[model samples]
Target: MNNRKYIMLDGKVIDKSITETEFVKADKNYLYDSFGKRYLDLRSGLWNTSLGYSDEIYFSVSKEFSRLMNKKLAYLDIHSFDCKLYDELSTNIISFVRNNMKKCIFTNSGSENTELALKIASAIYGKKLNVLAINNSYHGSFFGGMSVSGIDIDVNGRMGKAYEKVKFIDFPDDIISEESMLTWLEINLEQYDLFFIEPVLASAGVRIVSDNFVNEVLRLCKEKNTLTVFDEVATGFYRTGKPLFADRLKYKPDIICLSKGINNGISPFGSVCVSEGVLVRLEGKPIYHYSTQNGNLLSVSSANSVIKYYLKNGSLLEEKVGKIETQVKKVMKLYPNIVYRCVGAMLAIEVEKQDIMRLNTILKDLGILTYFYNQPTNGLTILPQFNINLDVLEKALRIILNKIS
Candidate 1:
């Protein structure tokens, strides 16, 4: 495919932009420029390119679904074989998912899953839409997700004081002390309808909640009649060393969000796994929250495949990621001034820099993708896929260390 207006116009982007080695063809896991240099994808290109490019199996499933989907939306639902595929995928996924979370509602993106979850929580629970979120969390750029998100100063106005309905909590970097959560709950947790969390806060820099603190939060929330919601958009799939972060944490959120990995089936698939209890509350409701492109045959087919691959052969990936974490710790020791975190395969290394741009420019050219010092981390992250090879990861880390040093 030709470039998306990026090639014809050279030197156009001026915002410390991300330019590929070439402006030419877009392929799976591989981007080729007019010059023909191949860049190994380190960041999964927006962190969603699992199963990599040139995944023929994924395309095959899409083609099979398209033969059935090249019709009207109405026909695509009732008369389409896609429904059976959806049922089968969802059914197969449940055994892999938590037992309390037994139902799923499909959506277009993780943000949609967040929105739908919040909406359902309020509709099913009550009009009080107050949700508690840790500071510096990244749910999404959209409003509902943004509203509950701890990302401060959202320029898009996706979040505002309009979302005062939401509450903010300090995510504990250490074991969330019972003393801390109980203290927090005493000051807050009132009229709080739901507690939303990323078991391992990724965007805030791979900070894992202390097991004791996490269990205490659940206990306190249940004691206080607060519902728990896990936003696993980034951590889902095999990214977190498990299919979902909650899987490792073993907590059944009233609503468990899924995206980014759902449709490694083809492209762009996301959804939510609603608990049986949440579903019970949502029954008999006249909520029309479905999206047309949602549950698309192509994406669902790919999502099913990704899930199968993980459930069947992802243990090896987990072992590799565990090693990557260990290696990262050893490397971080060389940079004592750098504050860092690595948990469940998500990682961040924060450096107090006088000029951040210099650091980013050096790393970007090295084929390592990362965000700037956004929030609390003041450092970016290394969020590779579960199946990402160890050598590929080590090369990136070493390159980063060399540049920083």
Candidate 2:
């Protein structure tokens, strides 16, 4: 009975009044609606807009892209004609993250990259193997990703469960002691062909994985010849005020999946970085894992610019994020009734009677936009641009506290 005049979403024509938040334009730090009402973007476009809406990098990349197109020097696809920029960007990314990764394969999104990482692991092992993923973790939206995700997804009253080979284990929690968890992992580690982890567990209320757990997992996986894939899709590219959350660990992961902040939310881009051993294993094999726009010039140019920006100014961003973290800590101290977790540029705020959807709407009405996480905990994650105005953010935090407290 419902027919939308123009747009069709989710296979149905939904009512227009369902959501009021509309964005017509955006600039550094804020999005402006049609009525010219500006809302500070706190989720950073799902934690990808690390460089904000507008920046010199964007302008420069656009100009470069235009010039390349005009000269017919820009090939849209990586497979068309090997572009040197592809390898250049990949090298720089590997260098920038400072991880001992060997090479990267470009993809269009985090989901694609994560799925691709899984494929790579399967291909290298040359068999169908079990996948071990932490409970409450989110890899991506693809079928392979959905299968391993900790949060149960249901479609038409049927649970969209993980693959038969996928197994879920509890993250180190109050009920599951770290020692017991380690013991369990030690006993059952070898059964898995791949072990997936989100360094910060961004979707799981910004839950940070402890060093001991990560180190133990890495050691066990290494001993078992299982590939440890770090799904840094959300925690990568300085979102955690560090180039990568994996860097803080005692050992390196076998593979690292990256996206989001690489292009500062300008282009659809992602890269799956693997260690030297993986690259060698698949060197001569026929690997069927590439899309037409896998290494499109638009994404490559934007990634190049973003990588360059971070290389030149990572320290400044770290300093700014440190200050913001301090301010948030102060706010948390003032409101002892609420719960909060902050690491680098990501912060989560929750209350006893948490209704994240309602709180999200309240924030939108208050001219502050954010995204909420559901599962294990209901909370709002404050993921602002690295260059967001400190005063504006401080005020917004107080406003959020006023509602929750």
Candidate 3:
């Protein structure tokens, strides 16, 4: 009946043509219906928007870029403020990753970064074309990302069959066990060009693998010359309490995928941190994967500012999550059946198995929104923004658990 509703339906039809995922009502940290019912942005823009809702730096930078373009915007190809901003952002990015990660390449979304990382791996090691991704991890919605995404509950039947070149290994969980994972890695990683994974499984309900296990995998990847890319789209920019939760684990990746928080949710730009091994050959011949909007000056400038903010408040970000982690585990212990998965800033509440969908719907009515995740582990993800007020967060969690019971 409403034009906005009609447009939303049409847009979904269009987007669904490309991918099976759809969106709910969202503008900033809040999503509203056509009727204008506001919902607390519990999921934080599908795990982006670390700063959440009307980020001042994004607005400020966007206004400046908009005003500059109003005067005389040069060809993005020609280079101007846009190019300078990207250079600065790259420098800021590389400084951290370079010391540990090695190199960086820009992309338009996490999926692009994932695909590009795979491409880089293929370009570097043609003999080992297979890329490994952890079972139950979510990277992106694109075909490449979907192919590597082992998140679907019935992916094999739904996606027809995974691409032969990409292998999905059962990522470690309480049930899977570390010894089983290491044996699996030892057997499969030798012939892989790239092995993609999340340091802490996010969509599959934030199950964290131990740092010791992660470092061992990295060692194996290095020995096999497999490019290991840690998909850090959710974990980056303080969501996981550190730039790379790998740092928390003391394991370094050859490539680390980043997005979501890159521009603080003002704009979208994704990047893959490349290691020295991959960058050394870039000068030999040009690698030609480019997006029209890749590293646009406006987004890059916003990203640089966002990183600056993260640097200043990084400790606080971790501290908040750290406190929440300790508190939730304590609270959850009081109600273990209701809260199932726990790792870092993300956690999942499991009510009666039959009541999962009802629990999700009821929580949305209670103002906290979460998604049905059937990957790596079948559970919902509670990825609140890094800056979500502690009181509001605890209240939300209480609401969520109470609604379920």
Backbone clashes for every candidate come to 5, 0, 2
Q: Which has the higher TM-score value, candidate number 1 or candidate number 3?
A: 3
What is the descending TM-score order? Answer: 2, 3, 1
Q: Write the per-residue lDDT of candidate 2 for residues 1-405, one digit (tens) a residue.
A: 346465534325655533456789889899999999998999898788888977586788888789778888655667767777888898789888767798888898998987788778778878776889888888886777877787644421164543657888887754357778888888888888888888777888888656777788788888888888999888887777678888777888988988899888788989888888888887766567879888778788889888888888888877887787887788789888788889888898865585778878888988988888777878888988888888888899999889888
Instruction: Give all TM-scores, in the order shown.
Output: 0.84, 0.93, 0.85
Better of 1 and 2 by lDDT: 2
Report how far off residue 172 is in candidate 3 (Å): 1.7
The better candidate by lDDT, 1 or 3, is 3
TM-score of 2: 0.93
Model 1: residues with Cα > 4 Å off, grouped in runs: 1-17, 20-31, 54-75, 78-82, 153-163, 176-178
Tens-digit lDDT string for candidate 3 (220-290): 88777777888888887767656667677645777788888877766778788877766875546434576
**Residues 1-405, model 1: lDDT tens digits:** 354544432224432234534447545444555667555555555567644564554565656566666653323442334477778778767766764788777677877887787777778665667778877777776667777777653542532643557777777655445477668786677668888887776666676666666666776776787888878787776676666666655345677888875655256777778777777777897675766677566666667766766677667767766776776777778777667777656677775663455676666665455555456746666665545566667777777766655
Q: Name the 10 consecutive residues with the lowest summed lDDT in model 3.
A: 11-20
Best by lDDT: 2
Superior candidate under TM-score, 1 versus 2:
2
Residue-level lDDT for 129 in candidate 2: 64
**lDDT at 165, model 3:** 69
Task: List runs of model 3 lying over 4 Å from the truth.
Answer: 1-37, 70-75, 78-82, 96-99, 152-163, 281-286
